[model samples]
Target: MIALSDTVSASSDLLSTEIDGEVVMMDMEAGRYLYLDRIGSVIWSELKRPQTVADLCQSLADRYAAPIEQIECDVLDLLQQMRRNDLIRLHD
Candidate 1:
């Protein structure tokens, strides 16, 4: 499970490209490709370096005028999905 303090980073074997504001990622190890929309693209960009879930929430909250609770929920959901897909790594 992803905690607020847990730091997340992109998997080393993944390569990403942005096309018209969206992101396309290739996982070399998994031999799969994934796509992200505008918001997911932002999340992908942030994960280039290790960052805590709290930092991600705050950064997203700053960009969008949404409630922190909602942003937190959405971010957590996305992170969990990414984790399942082996697109990101979580640090304890």
Candidate 2:
């Protein structure tokens, strides 16, 4: 599972984000478009790195100076929302 801590962008993919921080996804394979929000932005930014759940929790905790437990909860909750929207893929 990807954690919500680091940020990443690949050299290959092509998708343009809008002025209001809303994401517009362009599917290279299917040739389509999509949209995302500010909350999505936060989660998407974190997915830039191939980090584990623990690593992401640590990063969020450090960024907000919150407890690891609380950050872990936030990470899990945020990832859950992202997953529901098909914003990100979760790996084993």
Each candidate's TM vs. the true structure?
Answer: 0.94, 0.57
Q: Give one digit per residue, the lDDT tens place, for model 2 in 1-92.
A: 44444332222354656557766777576587666577556556666655666776676667676788877787777676655545555554
lDDT of 1 by residue, 7-91 (tens): 9998877888999999998888778899999999999999999999999999999999999999999999999999999989988
What's the lDDT of the predicted structure labeled candidate 2?
Answer: 0.60
lDDT of each: 0.92, 0.60
Candidate 2 ranges beyond 4 A from true positions: 1-40
